[model samples]
Target chain A: MSSFAPVLHSEWLKIRSVRSQCLALAAVLVSTTAFSVLMCATLSAEDTSEAGFDPVRASFFGLNFGQIAAICFGSLAVAGEYRNGAVLVSLTAVPRRGLFYTAKLTVVGLLALAVGLLTSATCFVLGQAALGDLGVGIGEPGALRSVVGCGVYLALITLFAAGLAAVLRSAPAVMGFLIPFLLMLSFVLGDVSEGGGWVDFLPDRAGQQILLQNPDGPLNPWTGTGVLVLWVAAALWVGGRRLMRRDA
Target chain B: MTSIDVTQLTKEYGGRRAVDGLTFTVRPGKVTGFLGPNGAGKSTTMRLVLGLDRPTSGTATIGGRPYAEIDEPLRHVGALLDAQAAVGSRTGRDHLRILAATARIPARRVDDVLEQAGIASAADRRIKTYSLGMRQRLGIAAALLGDPEVVMLDEPSNGLDPEGIIWIRRHVRQLAAEGRAVLVSSHLMSETASFADHLVVLGKGRLLADTGMREFIEEWTTPRVRLRTTDDVRLSAVLAEKGFHPVADDDGRWTVEGARVEDIGPLTAEAGIPILELAGEEPSLEHAYLALTAGEAEYTAPRPTAAVQEV
Candidate 1:
């Protein structure tokens, strides 16, 4: 087998070389932090002190928007190969379908993790500043967890989209299906079922639990994130099988 | 030297055979022209050989190993299946650099191939902004980056200008001269005739002919004799009586099919016919290709008269 380091390096070069992909990565940070600040600025101190209010969750409100850019970044990394027949060239170089798919997803996951960490930290710091006196400190119970969980959440969502993109083989198709499912379907299911039952297992709804201070869902914060991880593993498994069996 | 060996290779898509039990060898130190009409499986065969597509049966090997089994196959075989295969959002240089990195080729080799392909000036430009000709050059540059033993190019001259076409011919020849196995696929017979030392022709996903370039043309077409005699009337009657079907032209020249120059010269001398001009015409590669692939075209236009009548 070829060395994994070179394949990883090559996949990284592929992502870094494309301007649109870099822009998408930047959008992840900008959208998440900007939205978090906006939400934090508009909230009142009285609301923060409310009986059921969760300031840690409130700080990550921008994650909803930032995940979209993260999704784009992930999908573009994989689907870009299908576009313009780039996959053929990629497969030609690597030859081993498994190796190519693993290296590509590894690069996407790592980049998303790095960017997700930066975005989460920025959103937390700026979001607390915007909240002023109502803000929670990092040392506060569940505050650090939310900040770190927010990064992991973004990376998982990105990989989820990437895995789907590999199966669909088109960025637009992956985006069209994932964005609506993340923004509306999961929330609608949660609202209709009153945040209980099977809807709690839905990827976005379940994963977002880590950012919350209160435990309302049946699954805890870690368990909820584990549910999302299962979804990601499933997606990656199906995507890898498709890549191995299909023609480039 | 590494060479491609395809034996009984077959690929079927949804019960439709794209490549049907095709077998051929591409040896080193020669340019083998892969000729076929559209949808005749030229690209499919190349894909299978490169391991882009899984063959339904049999095997395609480079140097006795499957393409997928070879470590860093780009260092063994370089291929240009499509000129537009590179991501358009990246610069030309970045595209080659990515491939070079994957194959562990030196970074400087990327610039070397760019200059060799004659696209160094536009290496920094986004590939989306490049013209078709420039994209072709970039694709060629990517193929040569690894400097592999076997080179496979499918329709490499598709969008090239006349100069670019000539350059590709010379470049292909040079690769073969350096003892690399070069298989160039094209639908244009004349283009293949210009540089190929061997020929592999396909018809309807089946091997139609596999032989040397000269032998293939000679085997498919019969030689003809053309004579312009001083006594046209007597010469024509004598040739007809001797069981030769001579096609007379308005320019006073007669053409006889399946007749050699020596055969005609002896007959004319015995008849005391004064010949102004008598010469043997070599069979054309275009004619041989057309004849071999006559009914094998997957998509052919209807005749003009037939279309007019139907309308």
Candidate 2:
């Protein structure tokens, strides 16, 4: 166990010191946080008379980018060995495939959660402040839940993307397959799809459940989250099985 | 105790057999040069021993356990398959750190190995900025992180300069001196002559010869004696009288294969043949290897000029 700790620490160093994960996470936070502020500031004063704007949902719109970064990090973890033919070196060091896989997943998961939570909180606060007359405050009935939920949404979506990338084990293949799938769900699945009843089952739609400040969204917050978690678990199960059974 | 035991180890890629029935013990305190051509399965065999690749047929073990079964492999056996295999963006120290961490070695081991491989001063620099020799040193540092008993290096001197080549040779020799089983592979036979105590010569995916240095040298070398005498006619007559075959050259010299040096010198003097240049020629290890792997010499090192006479 202690031996594995250095491996984990090294993985952390690679993640933080390297360009990919840091840059991608930064992009996600900056884009999403900026978008939330811009959207809230543009909201007209008349909008407040009708209903409050969802500050949490507005804060998390950049999760779409954050999710991509998760996939990149995860895919690189497993597939980097293949690209360089260094898989031999890795397996030689830590022969247990399951342990190796677990360490990678743990590192990616922890980092994604930390960055997602930070980004979500920052986006929520900035967006709420910018809303002025039209914005929903944390004191509002569902505002805090929505704000926190946005963070969970970011983490879950990122993990799910990562698991998918791991299973595929090819960067181009995962990117090519997942990006369109994400785009389809966020854009195409949102329209002409029976008020997103089916779309709500996809990871992107289900993850969005936590961002509803009105507390009147189609799926209840927990159930929608469950749907997202189920998708992530299922993806991980498939990915983990593939990795376990195949030769590294 | 067996330094390394490989039993009927075999590896198949798709339909091709990479290592076919490769079974040999690598004893400690001696270098066993694994000689083979490109794509001749040297790396594949090493990979199987390290448990990086599963053998299709047999087992390869060290200390009575497969490599993958070892608790701390880097400490048990160190290998350098490729120096540049680790990511290039990380610094040299960082790359060693990750490997050292996995092996459960002390953090100081990273610096220790860096120093051992003589690259500690450049530890803080990024790997991408490293020269080829620097990367090779980093790779060796990673391998030595565990301070294992067995060290396997694949072409550690592949792209190195003459000085770097000598450096690797000295290090490898030192590793063996410490009673480690060092298996170094190369396609060149000349590299093995001095480096290997035991030689395993391979050609076109099959074992051509496996023997000790002295025995191989003796067996491969054909015996010949070169004699230069002023009285070529008298020597030829003495040779004909004794029924010995004498092949005279343009230099008024006779070359004999059966006569001993003691016999040749005295016989020439007794026969009234004043000798000028008299020397015995024996075959070298390179000659033996070329003769054994006749058609399989993929790339023989060009003979250097001012060649030493085989006397």
Candidate 3:
């Protein structure tokens, strides 16, 4: 394979150069932070008194809205190449199909990681400030994990979208498939399964376990993250295989 | 010598084969013009050569190595597959810069190629706002940025203006002269005729003719001798007696097919018929191409006159 570092740099340049892709990354930060602070401030005292009200998880309620931007960022990173037939030019430069796809995913993953980490950390700090005395600290049980888990969740979601985009070869199509699947289908899967062990294997449900405190889910937070990573790995493997087999 | 060689290459898309068993070599130090009508597999063959499309069978290599094996492929082969193969939202300079990074080409080379392609003024402008001609130039700039040994351009002159067309013709010739292998594909016969030293004509996913430009034209077309003398009627009689079939046009110029200048010149001088102009009319590349692929073309335009002449 060609030198990985230069390809990584080139892919990074590709992501930074496009205005819409960068805008999507910015949306991930803006939407996540703004919503998290709002959710923390607006939480009713009566609602907090109810059972199973995890303040740390509730602080990240804005992630429900923020994940969309992360998905878009990932999808556009790969699908944009198919937009004006730019994939041909990209593959021509780096003819090894597997290496090119890997480089592209690495760039998207890293950018998402950076944006995800900053956004998650900011949201945690700002959301705690809004919660006043009721706010949780990094020293609190599962607080640090939830804070760090937010960034991991966002990055994994981004990689998932990137992989799906490669397979589908359309940003709109990948978004169409993922948005409903993440926003509504995960709940539907839980409701239908009645908290069955099968629901723990679903990517979003398994990943969200990391962000929850005193989770009743079968898998631990780290293991839940591992499940999401497996889904991402499977997705990327399929996408890479298709990319290598198909004509540019 | 950085030549491109393909042996029995084939690509099948479903039941249809886009490029079937194509075998040819594009040598360095000369511009080889790839000619075929639309759907004749010119683009498909190019994609196969560049390793964009996986061949169903056989191999295509550059300098005895598959394109996938080459590190920094842009440094070995510079190809302009499509002008629109770029992010329109980015400035033209950014597109070249990203590609330059891939090849580890210096940042200054981006500006140099922009100047070389005559798009220096529009380098910082977003590609979406640029014209089709400008996009083509930007693609050219990106291709030459790495200063690759082999250049493959598929229909580079399509969106170019007349001046741009001439410029590309001259540019490819210069690249070839500098000892780089240049393979250019075009449907424009006149454009290919001007700069190409060699020709590789394709028809219906198969090779039609692969030879030198002059030789291909000569082999496919009948060279005719055009004669204009003081007395056309006498000259026709004299040429008929000399075992030459000369056809007279309405303008009184007689043309003899399958004849050379040497045979006609001496006969005209011996007759002392006041030969005003006796010149050999070299067959055009267009006419020769049409003759060579007369029936092999996958799709031909409907002729208004509707007369099919046998070659």
After superposing candidate 2 on the true structure, give the runs of residues whose Cα lies further than 4 Å from its correct spot.
A45-53, A214-219, B234-272, B295-311
Which 10-residue span in candidate 1 chain B carries the lowest summed lDDT? B293-302
TM-score of each: 0.93, 0.88, 0.95
For model 1, the stretches where C-alpha displacement exceeds 4 angstroms are B233-247, B262-274, B294-311
Residue A44 in model 3: shift from native, Å?
1.9
Question: How many pairs in model 1 have backbone atoms within 3 A of each other, for residues 3 or more apart or on separate chains, i.e. clashes?
Answer: 0
Model 1: pairs clashing at backbone N, Cα or C within 3 Å: none
- lDDT by residue (A1-248, candidate 3, tens digit) is 43888888899999889999999999999999999999889988997778888878877888988999999999999999998998888998888877888889988998899999899899989999898878888888999999889999999999999999989999999999999988888777778787557777888888988998887879889899999999999888888888987778
Listed models, DockQ each: 0.77, 0.53, 0.82
Q: Which number leads on DockQ?
A: 3
Minimum summed lDDT over a 10-residue window in model 2 chain A is located at A47-56
The iRMS of the candidates, in order, is: 0.7, 2.1, 0.7
| TM-score computed on alpha carbons, candidate 3 | 0.95
**Candidate with the greatest lDDT versus the true structure:** 1
Is model 2 an incorrect, acceptable, medium or high docking prediction?
Answer: medium
Once model 3 is optimally superposed onto the true structure by TM-score, how far is the C-alpha of residue B214 displaced, in angstroms? 1.4
Residue B58 error for model 2, in Å?
0.1
Give model 2's TM-score versus the native structure. Answer: 0.88
Instruction: Give Cα-based local distance difference scores for all models.
Output: 0.90, 0.74, 0.90
